[model samples]
Target: MELKEITDHPSYPDAYWAAGDEVFQLMDPLDAKRTLRLRANLNHNLLLHRRLFLADTSILVSPSMFALLHDEELGPGYRQLFRDGSIVTAMRSAANNFSEVAALIIEKRNFVAEMEEDQIWASARLLDSLSPEIVRTDTRDEMLKIGHDYVLRAEYWAALGIPENVALAMTESVRRKREERNLDTVRQSEFWEYARDDLLTPGEAGTAQQIRAYMSIASLGTMAKGIGIPPIYPAAYGPNVDRIYGTHTPWEHRADRRMKLLEPFDQKDPRRLDEERNIHEIAALLTADQVSKIRDKVEHRKLLKGAQQAIQESGNSAAEILERALEEFRGYLEVGAGEFLVDWEGGGRRSLLWETKTGQLMRQFSSGAVGTAAMIPGVGPALGTALTLFGWRRAAKLEKWREGFREVTQEAINDPTIIPELRTDEVIELSLFGEIPYSFMALGGDAEEQD
Candidate 1:
């Protein structure tokens, strides 16, 4: 039950624990071995999920994802990805989401039945030891925004026919509590609890339930807590209505604008429901890949332009500029074709393959007789050939990428190391180079129509 006992187990090596001050000092062979193993494990896991999450900045783990990562079967595998590094694993706030998770565990008492009390304690200890980052939002300006969002949400609910008195009371309670506690900001943990306890009489829970239902209908699930459906929603859908709209629109006009944007649709209309689903699927695909693709294109263009200008200004021949451009393109290809191998603890190694849209273009260019023609004296012909072959072999490569993505997606589902967040629908969208098929847009479209 003790921390030392839990960490010292054969399955849990010393490498798993945070290194102490002794690690900074000169170490014997045993200490050296421990540090080396720790470094290797951290590096291996970093490479595993970096491609999937594009977590060059930070990986923000939701409460659900965090708990799932700590589950008995999946814990060890997912923990590998959370190793101490420059790219941190962070929760939104310690006083917010993390506290909610603790509260949930206490409330259920058997939420994770297999997780013994001591194990739970040890898990908390491990989290402390790892020192995963927390996003701070306690500044004065942030608190003002937070307060505004609370009132905005309340006003939205009132617009949807919740009693004006009820809505005012809810917002007023929050304002009163902030003053009473001498707090600038209300953490998510405090806000939700306050809403439930103070929204109505002590025994009345109906108002809180109603508010929750309305929030769900609007695709707003604890916006202050963590990542939700809003991030994946298109800009026109008013995803930033809670925070950004308040800054531009005055309080009086805000409700009308939000109501128009978030107008309720017929839940029973199959066509309407289908359209909503399609929009979400398309949005998720765009969120995951299209933006990245656009950025890559812009960057590629800049690189080519820069290369040409440098060569031309230096009094280089046209061929030299072309050669420089080609070198830049080749470097882009190398970086885009991200192929890495994962060594499994069970013994065998598996490969994770990723290719940018340009990789396919490169393949098509290299395949045709035009590629031979591209060997002319000037670089103009080669550039023309490359551009011409951009859409060539599209169908074949699309199919190949789709199949490969599906296989890796399956591997992700079965393997805990790779988070199973990628969807087949998104893969199909990516395969089409960000195009959503008409069938995908239709109600109850046949599976065969996907091709």
Candidate 2:
């Protein structure tokens, strides 16, 4: 017997025959419209599932949601899902998504610390919940090796329309540039005065990079000590620090300070630096008498202490002072030496918030040092320290990416066709196989049955 005839008059069980018959019907021209509609629905379901899965994962790992999962009144439903292994599935999905995103960022060398802040908090919570034995296990290391292998084979640079070699070289160039900047900053810093001979007695070709990393931590320690704040080392330091220091100075104020200090060192555009240089050159053209007369006409500008003074004047307790000082130091690393600038007799500072090109460069160098230190094994755990050191410009990039995800989720929610109503025929067909279509379940079909 021919295949069509056998399928049409099969002696198989009813369930098997029903599945085969559905496939045959799908292939028939008489059922063409239904087949196309089914295909469209399948595509829509896949798209919707992807969007929902991502959103669910984000919410699940969010700090707010993680805290809510402990609530007595509202925790039972989520706890039940955990017991049934749904939460595990969601967490695994989140891990995979994070790994992929991390691989892309590593390949592109566009490290955005704030974008991973939520995930880092989630991972910290998981570690905190685990037993000591589980925490000591090498499962995370093994998983990271697996992720590294997958990234190597995936060739993520291909997606960026660049060759792997070029992408790698670009990453290397950025690393080299950062290292050089860190070295320069260390040499210029007060810490460098004490540690120069130790660092410069180079034993290896990459000694500078090693020293740069060390300087980052040493500088942090020095800064903390200078402010009379004892260093606190928690397994997950970032979120804890944020909660403690958040009340002292707003992130907006810190960000504004960072921008003012680092704006002249912007690598993407050299116009600002050039414009400043031109102004200095024009000043040099003026005679000494003329420059002295112009300086006399300018208003005297006193250095603004701002947050530093506010923290000191708050009259808080010892512990409170330490916390505020740590927060202040965090801001200082971001702005560098410009955090304390003085007006000179020869130069009339016109701007109320005056930071020279030299000051901006110093800020960049200091940032490089602190950022390098944050990557060390145990030094910088606080999120605020890492975020401040890494630069606030990345926050803008993160917001843009988040807005795109929000738009996609909104579009999916608004589209009626993406999750169509289940018809009786479809329900009966799916039920024959001892299964219910997800669309039906999603549309509250299982709720009534459960009750």
Candidate 3:
């Protein structure tokens, strides 16, 4: 490739090129030649390196905009948060509850209009005396209002990982490209081809690939490429233009460090093999229908292994496991006492029930309640909700509580108040439930045996 092909882009950073020379010098010439160039915006470079097996000589660049924005303290550094798997999570949430979002948009428009009228009336006496300046003043006020609205919207988008400046730039870039190519009327496949082959530079192409791999969305599907929706949506989906305009923040670097801290507990941890083997055997013995219900529950492999180990060591009978799972499933039906709390009960659940999901209860829990969490079996909404509780506890640094909750829940299954309905592999159901019990909290528990 020509030097210009690598260095000509506005997104290309000077430090990246400077760093490249040092990295390249350390590489064997043949390996350097074979190295593939992969550029990502912000801290996504770390993700590319860790996930894609990128060579040291491979050119990795961040947008120059990120470098410029660093002075503002809201630049690429903040952008790294997007790569922390939070943005994608937020967007998925928004997409899942689009109807509620649409309703909110309508409500906000009306609220804004009402506020503007009140403000205008409050300033009417001052406006009446200066008629000539009123026009200019009113126009300026309107522009300021517009700017403020845009900023708020931009912040909302940024929280979903799309920075405002990057979003705007992507909009302009897509508009320019579509007009230049006259791709407005192009078919989906043809537009996708153009987007992949012509619209993006090499760095952008690499970024787009990363976004696709990361998002798991390879194409726009039946969605056409056009100048509609400010063009940025297509560009973001196609060439990853948003990432091309930002950089990573210090916060993102810290997040990466935290992620690294969790690496030692990964699948290869020697202490987890026995538990994993038990889980595997249990999984093989589970009913196919039961397996499908808990598919989304166990995201953390290490955590799941630990939960399995807890259950295996408990020496509980298969009938006891079934009873515990059934009781937990029943708990989910008790609306007010369900497994999910307000903030924890996310997704579409928030819209369905409000009385049981009071903000006060969640606030108390978040403020430091030694809340209960459990590992129980059975299909239905309860399993996912239980897992969500466990996730919140883990995120909140309630490691002891989490382990205790798990142990307590496991023991709770043996309560005579509830009847065991289903008989499946105890380990499989317990694995799906995925929580460690707090045995010490129960009456006959050993205080010294802590997780």
Model 1 CA deviation exceeding 4 Å by range = 1-67, 84-87, 91-121, 131-140, 146-157, 198-451
lDDT string, candidate 2, 1-451, tens digits = 0001011211101111111112112112333233222222222211111111112123323333343345454344333433332222212221333334334334433221222545544544442332111000112332233223321222422222233453354334433544755522221122222223333443321222222222232222222222222222211112112222220001111222221213211234322223222223223223222322222321101011222232233112322332343344333322332222234222324221223252232122111011100211111111112222112222223445335434433443343221011110100111000111111011111221100
RMSD of each: 20.3, 31.8, 27.4
State residue 82's C-alpha deviation in candidate 2, in Å. 63
The all-Cα superposition gives candidate 1 an RMSD in Å to the true structure of 20.3
lDDT of 3: 0.23
Q: Candidates' lDDT values, in order?
A: 0.28, 0.24, 0.23
Best by lDDT: 1
> 2 or 3, which is superior by lDDT?
2
lDDT of 1 by residue, 1-451 (tens): 1111111111100011111111111122333233322222223222211111111011221222335345575345445444432223223232333334444454534132333555555455555454443333222344455446543356644544455777777666766766776765543333445555666663344445434323321222222222211111111111122122211100111212211111111112222212222222222212112223422464446544643343233212432343445345445433442222122221112111112142122121111111000111122121111110111112112445435434433432343111112111110000101111111111112122211
Maximum-TM-score candidate: 1
- Models 1 onward score TM values of 0.32, 0.18, 0.20
TM-score winner between candidates 2 and 3: 3
lDDT of 3 by residue, 11-83 (tens): 1000111112211112122221112111112122221111111111111111122122232433333233322
The alpha-carbon deviation from the true structure for residue 213 of candidate 3, after best TM-score superposition, in angstroms, is 5.7
Q: How well does candidate 1 match the true structure in TM-score terms?
A: 0.32
Give the clashing residue pairs of candidate 2, or none. 237-382, 238-382, 238-383
